[model samples]
Target: MHSEVAQLFRYSLGFIAAISFVACLCIIALAQVFPWLCGRRDDENAVQSMHSRPTPRIGGVAIFFTLALGVVFAPTTIVQSYLGVIIATTLLFLVGLSEDLGFRVSPRRRLLAVCVASLVVIVLLGVWLPRISMPYFDLLMQYWIVGVPFTLLITAGVANGFNLIDGVNGLAALTAIGASVSIALISLQAGYDTMAMVSMMLAAVIFGFFLVNFPFGIIFLGDAGAYTIGFVLSWFGIAVLIDSSQVSAWAILLTLFWPLADTVFAIYRRSRSKKDAMAPDRLHFHQLVMRGLEICILGRKRRRIANPLTTLVLAPFVIAPQVCGVLLWDHNRAAFFTVLAFLAVFIASYLVAVPAIRACRQRPQEA
Candidate 1:
C-alpha cells in the first residue's frame, strides 16, 4: 500500500461526493412526483417517532446506487480495490432494504445476515479485529475460533447500534460524518491509503443523505442506510487496525463510542425491565436529549424546531471522542483510558438527564 493516496483517487473523491448528493435529491424528487411508486413513506407513529410528516425512507437505495455508479465512472483502480468488501455487505444492505420497503425482516434474520457479511469480509478481505493490547485476551484473538466470533460480534453490534440511533433528524448521518472523517484522518496518518479514501467517500455518501434528512426531515435514513454506514465504518476500523501496527484498537473504539455506548445502554436499560432486547423504545441517549429539548426548552409544539436542534445540541458530545481518537490513535494506554472516561460520562449524563426531563414533563400534568 502506498503512503500517498493515489492522485486519481483524490480527484475521484469529489466525483463520489457529487454523485451521492445528486442521487439523494433525485430520490426525494421522484418520491414527490410519483408518491404511489416511491417505495415506502414512514408513518412516524412509533414510540420513537420524532417527525410529523410521512417521508420517503429509502435513502439507502440512492446511496448504494451512487456506490454502484462510482464503480463504473470513478477511477476503476480505486473502486475495484474495495469491491469484495462492498459485495460482502450486499446481504446486510438488502436485508435492511427489505425492512425499509415495509417488508418484514426479523431481527434474528438481520443479525444472521450481518454475521454472514462479517464472515465474508474476514475471508475475502482478510480483515478482522486484531490485537487490543490486552494481555491474555489479545493472544486468544490469534485463533480462528475466537477471532471469527469477535469479528462477528463487532459487525453485528455496530450494524444494529447505528440503526438504533437513527431516530432523530440528522442524528445518525452527522455522527457518521464525524466518524468517517475521523477514520480517514487516522487511516491517512497510519499510511493506509485505500482505507482513508474509502472512508472519505463514505462521508460523502452520508452528506448527500443529510441534505434532505436534517432540519426539516424530507427523507428518513431508515434501517438500510444506518446499517450500511455502521457496517462500513466498523469494518473500516477493523481493516485499519489490521493494517497498522501503530494504531490502537482502543482509539478506533473511541471513534465509534457514541453508537456503541448508546446501544449497550439501551440493552441494559431494557433488560433491567425484562423487556425484549430487540424491542424499540424511546430510552436511547439521543431520544432522551431530543425529548429534553422538547420538554424544557422547545416545548412539545415546536417539533420542527426541536427535532434538528437536538442533533445540533448533541453533536459536540458525539464528535469529541472521534476527534480525540484521531489524536490518540497510536497511544494505546491513553486511548484505552479515554474510552473508559467517555463511557462513564455518557452513562452518567443519560441517567441524570432522562429522569430530570421525565419529572419536568410530569410536573405540569401533576399541577
Candidate 2:
C-alpha cells in the first residue's frame, strides 16, 4: 500500500512538471505572436532604447495565461488552498499590463494595488505563518497581527525588487530563477506539496523566459513579467514559511536575503538623501556591475572576457553565500545570526569594492 501510494505521488508530480514545461513553451510562442496580432508593435519601440534591439516586452501575458491554465488543471486540493495565488497573480498581471501600456500610474497607486493583492492571498486565502520563533522565546504569538503587515510588505517588496533589478539583461531573470529554485527546494524538503508545485511551475516558466532574456537578449520580462514573477515568488516564500513544520521562520529570511537586503538598503539610501523613498535610481549593485562592464567593453579590451567576467565573477561571490547559509542552518536563531553576519560582510565588501572599481575607471586614458 505504501509503495503504491509513493509511486502514484511521483507520477502525479512528473505529470505536473511535464505540463509546466509545455505551458512555458506555449506561452513564449504566444508572447511572440500576440503583438503582431493585436496591432501593438509600436510598444516594442519603447523598449528598443533600453535594450540593444527591439524585443517583445509583453511576455508576462503568456506566463500568466499559462499559469492560470495550470492552476485550472491542478488537483482540487492544491487549487483550493492556492486559490489566492491564482487570483493575486492575475491582479498583478493586469496591473503590470496597465503600466506597460504607458499608463502613468504613480508609485502610491502601484503600492496600493500590491497591498490589495497581498491581502487577498494572506488574509482572505488564510495563507499566513501561525508562529514565529524569537531569539529566546520558542514560539512567539501575535502572528495574526504581525503576519498581515509582514505579508503585505514582503509581497509588495518582492514585486518591486524584481522590477527595480530589471535594468540589465539576464540579471532580474537570473535572480528570479535562483529564487524560484530555492523556494521549490525548500518547500519540497518541508513537505509542502502545493507550494512546491507552484514554485516548480514558476521556475520552469522563468527558465523559458530566460532562454530569450539572457546573452542573446531576445525579449524583456517588462513590468508584467516582473510583477507576476515577484508576486508568485513572494507568496510561495510566505506559504513555505507559514505552512512548513520542518522549516523555521528564519530560514525564510535567509532564502530571500538578497532582495530583502537590497530593498531595505535602497529605502534607507533614498531616505538619507532626502529623496522620495520610491524614486528610481541606478545605484543598485547590478547597475554598478553594468557600469563596470560598459567601461571595460569601451576600453577596447576583449568583449568576450568582460561580459562573462562581470556576471560570473561577481554573482557567485555575492549570491552563493546567502544560499549556502539558508541550506546549512536549520535553527531559527542560528540562521538569523548567520544572515546578520553575512550582511555585515556584504556591506563591508561593497563599500571597499565600489570605490575601488570607480577609481579604476576614473583614471585618465593611457597616452
Candidate 3:
C-alpha cells in the first residue's frame, strides 16, 4: 500500500507538470498560428454557434500535440504500450484538422476515416469490446462476428459523438475532463497504473484547454481535439474493462453515457424530422438548455452571458454519471440498475425542459 501510494503521487505530479507545460506552449503557439490554419467559420452550416466573430476552430491542433507531448514524457514505465492508441487517435485528429482547414470532406468520408482508425486500433492493439455486463449479450459477444463489429461501431460512434457535442463553447472539453477523471479513478483503484496515468494526463491536458475556452470563449476545441478525446476515453474505458475484473460494465457505460446518449438522441430526433442524422442543427440538449437559460434565467438583459454560463450550468450534470460510475465501480448489478434509472430520469427531464423553454420563448410574441 505504501508503494502504491508513492507511485500514484509520483505519477500525479509528473502528469500535471508535463501536460500543463505542453498545453501552455501549444496554446500560445496556436493562438499565433490558428488564424492562418483555420478557415472562417461557416455559420450557414448551422454548426457554429453565435459568437463575436469567426474565432479559430483549430484549437484541437494544440490539444492533440500537447497531449502527445505529455504522453511521450509521461512518468509511466508502460507509456509505449499506448503506441497503437496514440497513432489511431492522431489519424482521427488529422482527419478532423483537414475538415477544419476547409477541406470539403463529406460526412460519409469523415465517418469512414474514423472507422478506419478504429479498425487499426482493433487489428493492431487487440483492444475490442469482449463482453457487456449482461450474460446473454456477453455470450453472444464471444463470437468474433458479434464482438468485432460491435467494437468498431462503438469506437466510431464515440468519435463522431465528440464532434457532435462540440457545438457549444467549453462543453466538449469540460465533459471530457469529467469523464476522464472518473475513468482514471476507476483504473487506479483497480491497480491499472498505465491506464490511470494516461487518463489523468488526458484530463489535465483538457482542463488546461478549458481555462481559455470557458467564460470568454477565446478558442474552440475543434473536431481534432474533440474526436481525439473521445477516441482516447473510449479506448481507455475498454482497456480497463478488459484488463480488470473488478470494474463493472456499468462503469464504462456511465463514463460514456452523456456523449453516446446525446448522439443517439440526435439521430432519432433527426430521423423523425425527415432530416439526415448527421445534419447539423441548433436544437441539441445543450443548445436547448442554453436557450432555456436565455429565456428564463439570463433574460434579454444578460443574453450575451448565456453561452459560457450554460456550459458551467450543464457541466455538473454531464459529470454526474461518471461520479455515480466511480462510486459503484465494484458493484456491477447495482451500477447497472442505477444507470438505467438515471437514464430514464434524464430523458424525461430533457423532454420536459426543451419544450418548456420553447414555450417560454414563444409566449412574449403570442402575448
Candidate 4:
C-alpha cells in the first residue's frame, strides 16, 4: 500500500494526472468558444439523447490526448509494456470519434473496430483470460482457442456497453471513475504497482471530464469517450488478472458490472422484441429512471433537472458492486456469488421498478 502511494506521487505521474485535468478543462473551454469544430453537437432529437440543447460531444479527444502524454512521461518499461494497448485504444477511440464527428460509422462498424483493436491487443500484449473460475470452462480457458475468442467477445461487448450507458449526464463518467478507483485499490492490495498506477491514472483522467459533465451537462462523453472508457477498463480487468493469478476474474467483472449489466439487459430486451441487439433504444436503466423522474415527480418539462438527477439516483447502484468487488478481489467463490447476487438486484430493478414507472407514465393526465 505504501508502494502504491509512492508510485502515485512519483515518476511524474501526479504531474501527468494534474496536466490531464487541466487539458480536459481546456477542451471544454475551447468547445464553448468554437462549438462547430468540436465534432457533432447533440440535442434532444436523437432517440438516445437526454439533453435539451446541442452540446459538443468530442470530449474523448481531450482524454486520449492527455492519456498519450501521460504514457510519454511514464517509465520506459511501463510504456513499452502498454504501448500496444495504448495504440489499440487510440484506434478504437478514433473510430468512435469519427462517429462523434458526425460521420457515417454504423454500430456494426464500431463493433468491428473494437474487435480489431482487441485482436491487436491480445496478439501484441498476449493478454487473454487464462481461466474462468469454472471447472470445465477453466480447462477450456487454459487453451488459447477458447480464451482468445472469449476475451475478444467480452472486450468488444464491454466497449459497446459503455456506449449503451452514456444516457444521463454523469452516469458513464462517474461510473467509470468509481470502477477505475476500485480496480486501482485492488491492484494496490495485490502489490501490482503498474496496474494500480494505470487504474488511478484512468480515474484521474475521467474525473476531469466528470467535473463539467455532471449536473450542468456543459459537455458530453460522446461515443469516443464512452467506448474508450469501456475498452480500457475491460482490458485493464484482463491485464490485472493475468498479472496476478490471485485476482478473481469474477471480481474484475464486478467492478465493471454496472455498464455491462445494462448492455446485457439491452441485448436481452432487444432480442425478446426480435430487434437487432445493436439497435438503439431509450429503454436503458438510466433512461427509465430519467423518464420516471419526469412522469412521477419532476414532470416532463423538468428534463433539465431530471437528467443529471437520474445519474445521482443511480450512482450508488454503480458504486456498490465495485466496492463489493474490490473488497473481495481475491476471493473467487465469494466474488462469483456476489456477482450473481448483484445480477438479481439489477434484473429486479429492471423488471419491477422500471415497468411500474412505465405504467405510471403511460396513464392519461387528469383533466
Candidate 5:
C-alpha cells in the first residue's frame, strides 16, 4: 500500500509539473508578442515599478488557468476533498487578475475579497487555526469563534504579503518557490503526500516563470501572480498544520518567513516615517539591497545586471529560515525559538544594510 501510494504521488507530481512547464513557456511567448493576451504593464505610477518598458504582468493568468486545468487531472478523491480550497484560490486569482489589467482596485476591497475567500475555506472546508504553538493562544484557538477570525486575519495578511514583496525581478517568485519547497518537505515528512505534491507543483510553475523573469526581466508576475501564489502557499501551509499535529506552527511560519518578515518591517518602517501604512515606496528591504548591488557590487558599468543579481545575492538569506524550519519541523518549542532567532538576524541585517545602501545611492556617479 505504501509503495502504491508513493508511485501515485510521483505520477501526480510529474503530470502537474509537465503541464505547468508548458503553460509557462506558452505564456512567456505570448507575453512578448500578444500585448492583450497578458495584461500590458506600463511602468507608471506603481510602487514596484523598476523597469522602463511595458511588459505583461499577467503571468498569474497563465499560472491560474494552467493550475485549474491541472486540477482536473488530480485524483477524484483529492479533488472532491479539496474542492473548497480550489474554489477560493480561483476567486482570489480573479481579484488579482482584474488589478493586473490596470483596474483601480481599492486596497480595502482587495483585502475584503481575500477575507471572503479565506472565510469560505474556513466555514465550508473546515480549515482553520487549530493551534498557534503558544499555550495561551492554543487554548483560546480551540474555540471556533476565536480560531476562525484569527485564521482569516493570517490568510489575508499572507495573501497581501506576496504583493508587498513583488518589487524586483525574481524576488517574489523565488521566495514563493522556497516557501513551497519547505511546505512540500515538511508535508512529506508528516506523511501527507497529496499536499506535498501540490506544493512541489507550485514550486515547479514558479521555477518555470522564474527563468524568463530573472536576469532578463522579460515578464513580471504582477498583482495576479503574487496574490495567487501567496494565497495558495499560505493556505497549503495551514492545511499541513491542520492535517498533522506533528507539524509545528513555527515551521509553517518559517516556510513563509521572508515575506512575513518583509511585510512586518515595511509596516514598521512606514509608521516610523509617519507615512500611511499602506503607502508604497521603493525603500523596501529588497529595493535597498538591489540599489547597493547596483552601485557597489555591480558597479556603474554593470548596473544593468543589478536587478536580477539582487535575487541571486539575497535568495540564500531568505531561504535559510525555511531550511532551519524544516530541520526543526518536529520540535515545536525549538522551531519557535529558531524562528525568532532567524527573524532577529534578518532584521539586524536589514537595518545595517539600509544605511550603507543609502550612502551608495548618494555617492557620485562613476562615469
Candidate 6:
C-alpha cells in the first residue's frame, strides 16, 4: 500500500508538471500575438520615458487562461481542494484587466472587487488562517467573524502588494516565481499535495512570463497579471498553513516578508508625508535601485552598476534571513520575534538609504 501510494503521488506530480509547462508555453505564444491583434505597438517613447516599453500589458490574460486550464485539468484531489482559489483568482484577473485597459476604476472600486472575491473564497471555499500560536493563550479563539475579516484583509493586501511592486522589469514576476516554487516545495514536504500542485502551476506560468519580462523587456504583467499572481499565492499560503498540523501561521508570514514589509513601509511613508495613501510614487526599493543605477552611470563613477543588479543584490538579502529563520526555528514565538526584528532592521535601513539615494540622483553631473 505504501509503495502504491508513493507511486501515485509521483505520477500525479509528473502529470501536473507536464501540463503546466505546456500551458505556460501556450500562454506566452498567445501573449506575443495579442498586441498586434489589438492594434497596439510596443510604445517606443514610453520605453524611453519610462523604464520599460509599453508591451502588450495583457500578458495576464494568458496567465489567467493557462492557470485556469491547468487547475481544471489537474487531478481530482487538487481540483476539489483548489476550486475556490480558481474562482477567486478569476474574479481578480477580471478586475485587473479592466484597470489595465483604461477602465476608470477607482482605488475604492478595485478594493471592493478584491473584497468581494476574498469573501467568496473565504466564506464559500473556507480558505483561512485556521491556527496561530498565541504566546499567553493556550488556544486562540477561532471566531468566524474575526477570522473572515482578517482573511479578507490578507487576501486584499497580498493582491495590492504584487500590484504595487510591478514597477520594474522581472521584479514582481521573478519574486512570485521564486516564492511560489519555495512554497510548493514546502507543501510537498508537508504532504499537502493539493497546495503543492497549485503552487507548481503558478510558478511554471510565472517563469514563462519572466523570460519575456527580464533582461530585454518584451512584455509586462500589468494589473491583471499582478492581481492573479497575488491572489493565488496568498490563497496557497493560507491553504498550506490551514492544512498542516506542524507548521505555524508565522511560517507563511516569514516567507512573504519582503512584499509585506514594503506594503507597511509604503503606508507609513505616505502617512508621514501627508500624501494620499493610494497615490503612486517612485520611492519603492526597486525604484530606488533604478535611480541609483542611473545616477551612477551618468556620473561616470568608477563603480557603475545595472538596475537588475540592484534588485539582485537587495531582494535576496531581505528575503533570505527570514526564510532561514522560519525553517530553522520550531517555536512560533521565537520565529515571530525574529521576523519582527528583521522587519525593523529593514525599515531602518530603508530610511537611512532613501535620503542618500535621492541625493545621489539629484546631484549635478560634471560638465
Winning model by TM-score: 4
Q: Given candidate 4, what's the lDDT at residue 62?
A: 71
In order of appearance, the predictions have TM-scores of: 0.93, 0.81, 0.90, 0.94, 0.91, 0.83
RMSD of each: 2.3, 4.2, 2.6, 2.1, 2.5, 4.2
User: Candidate 6 residues 1-367, lDDT tens each?
Assistant: 3353455446544554455445545655675666442223433333222343345566677677767777554557767656767787777788878766656566667767888888778776765666555643324426766666777788778788888777666778777876786676667667776566667667767776776667555566778888788878877787787777666666666666677777888888989999887777778776666666666553434112454555566667546754653473345776677777888888787777778876776666432
Q: How far is candidate 5 from the true structure (C-alpha RMSD, Å)?
A: 2.5
Q: What is the lDDT of residue 27 in candidate 4?
A: 72
Runs in model 1 deviating more than 4 A are: 1-10, 33-42, 72-81, 365-367
Put down candidate 3 lDDT per residue, 1-367, tens digits, no spaces: 4465456557664566456545645665665766645454564245536555556677787677767776564545656657777887778888888877777666777778777887888888765887778878888886868988888788778877888888667889888888888998898788887677678778877877777777677667777778888887888888898889778988787888888888888888899999998787887788787778879777965645888788878888788898999988888999999888877876888899987987898898999
Ranking by lDDT: 4, 1, 5, 3, 6, 2
The number of clashing residue pairs in each candidate reads 0, 0, 0, 0, 0, 0
Error of 5 at 285 (Å): 1.2
Question: For residues 251-348, could you state the per-residue lDDT of candidate 5 as single tens digits?
Answer: 99998888888888888988999998777788877887777887766775554587778888889988999898889888999998888898799889
Candidate 1 has a TM-score of 0.93
- Preferred candidate (TM-score higher): 1 or 2: 1
Q: Candidate 4, after superposition: displacement of residue 210 in Å? A: 0.8
What are the lDDT scores of the predictions, listed in order? 0.82, 0.65, 0.77, 0.83, 0.79, 0.67
Off by over 4 Å in 2: 1-52, 72-75, 135-143, 297-310, 317-322, 365-367
Candidate 4, clashing residue pairs? none
Worst lDDT run of 10 residues, candidate 6, spans: 37-46
